[model samples]
Target: MADAPQTMVIVGGGLAGAKAAETLRAEGFTGRVILLAEEREHPYERPPLSKGYLAGNSAREKVFVHDPTWYAANDVELHLGVTVDRIDRQAREVHLADDGVLGWSRLLLATGASPRTLDVPGAELGGIHYLRRLPDADRLRATLRTLGRENGTLLVVGAGWIGLEVAAAARAYGAEVTVVEPMATPLAVALGPELGRFFAQLHQDHGVRFHFGASVTSFEGQDGMVLAAHTDDGEEFPAHAVVVGIGAAPNTGLAAAAGLELATGPGEGGGVAVDGSLRTSDPLIHAAGDVASAEHPLFGRRFRVEHWANALNGGPAAARAMLGQEVVYDRVPYFFSDQYELGMEYSGYAAPGDYARVVLRGDAGRREFIAFWQADDGRVLAAMNVNIWDVTAPLQALIRSRRPVDPDRLADPGVPLTEL
Candidate 1:
């Protein structure tokens, strides 16, 4: 095969994988492109899984990044339900689960992440679910429909994004919803305590129950089905079905098995370590999306973001880096969520204890607001806009500029974000 152009193999058929393949072709790569997907479906987005899709407001086919014909039209081989068992870096090959081997000139890891599981006695029960994939969402949707709005209880194990979104959707279907968060406030690490409390109130106002600072000791079930959740505080929350959305664990097993670099120790999010350009330790290998804890020159830190924006953009950046292009995976991290009637967008990075102040431009109770986090020096650390539109560009600039601005000016509705 010396006469043939080099082949590029990409693992993980998700948003990142789809974008990488698209970028390679758009950038004029004439070589063979192969996408190995563990799921039977085509590359799709997971954001809608808990909201529109699970709530029955969205069509299933709309979640996919591309239809079946797109891959074949682009001359990309899309292999469904195939797993890469090992990465032979020395041989520049990947061993498949079916005992097949594939040689590659370059490899991209877009393995994404898996939902973190709860370790409890009755966790394996039939009425328990996690929402990370389409199938998971489908099952949850079916259960919610069967329970009906007047029927059973939906006990959510966490108040993170997925958990909160699922709670909202379940509530919309008229199911009784209760969220249990070990943290006193929901999304505290991202939005800080005050805003997290605001979300707690928002959910409560809509009739969602909360058990803050409580840990689930175990789930109680009958005949291999979860019936109730018992808390460490000796409280029992009865449920017809339970959905756990604690968080996600990056899918880095294959990379770890291949002795690839991982982000370990202080401030490093756990995932495969990659340089600014998304190139892994091996020159021929790269990683992107949820699986890559990549360094960002702009943020001056490494982060593993599991949002749609990161995957939508990170995939292209990794593909360009795989082509030996001088690039930086330095886009301002962004993500958004919709619950009930509230729609919010957040940009920039903020770690726990990273910012010293929080300023608001509108009423938190009114649900029309822009919240900004600033360091002691007044440099904007992060910004979130709820029920706001067309302000993300300016909001992103405010964060990227790193300019020290007066808190008064930031909170004043008359002063535009860009002017600040």
Candidate 2:
């Protein structure tokens, strides 16, 4: 007798979930596949939410990962606007909020994450937004269109990528923007202190105000809209609207309840713990995207990276591993940001004590340069390029291969990176 068809059930409908589904089809898996998404819309690209989408440069229709026809043609089942409330690991079943249980041979949890909210007075008031979904961007875009930018003050909380991107969008619309960060400089945690200082200066040059080492204590609202916010330093600033881009907490409650090991390390929070194969402790289950804290070969650490490239790259890697053809997740981590007229690109890994030399190419004063981090053994550990892209690709290849290059040669702008 023939064996029963394999059934693969995927939870979440973000980039990771969508990419996994596409990969399964591409691998010629003719099994029964189901995708469950809580959001009503199709899976879409999220990076644009803070930039082009906010600036009206890209339309909502253009952001979809794959059109409806593609999914239909692939025989993949999509359960849109439905939430998966529980996971029954024993039965390999997923309990849906809409009164249904999905049985599966293999389960992939790509539940993704939600924006972290600030615990402050009047935070529930209107005119305060968080940009994570399309609806959030739509609402903010409408406000920008109606208020005409210059007519309002935009207060942004946190100096992370999302906050900085939103600040850039608001400033582009001609609004007066102020960013409040408890750290001494923007992106301090991710880029370290020196690069963080450069980021702070980058934004300051574009007319964005930075309130460093200041924390928001309370929010003041009038007529259902936020009017001002009080800081820890006993100071208050008036605002027309507020945006909180502090960070995100992974959607891992269901996975934890199902007895899957979750990430608990320093940078890992609310994300599932996965092995090098991207498989959870329970081999029957797998995790990916922002919800999976898989081991990073380059950094010698395990942490969740909230980046578009990771979602696109890691999703397929996890899917391939799930299919029993294991692939090493060793790609160099890469991410980019666009704020004002500056375009910054980061490639490779930078961990404490991993680098012994910091080489600079181009002019830091002109805000167009590349900083290469090199280990004492002479391997390129990481590279941060601001408005400089010509040399990044070759440097990225060398970093991934763990190739050694002379530090002085790397700093020479006139010399080719390949020669190093």
Q: What is the C-alpha lDDT of each candidate?
A: 0.92, 0.86
TM-score for each of the candidates = 0.98, 0.96
Give the alpha carbon lDDT tens digit for every residue of 194-243 in model 2: 78888888888888899999999999998898999999998898999889
lDDT of 1 at 107: 98
What TM value does model 1 have?
0.98
Output the TM-score of candidate 2.
0.96
Clashing pairs in 1: 149-174
Model 1 ranges off by over 4 Å: 1-4
lDDT of 1: 0.92
In the order shown, the candidates' Cα RMSDs to the true structure are 1.2, 1.7
How many steric clashes between backbone atoms does each model show? 1, 0
Candidate 1: residue 29 lDDT (0-100): 94
lDDT per residue, candidate 1, 295-345, as tens digits?
Answer: 989888887888999999999999998888999878999999999999999
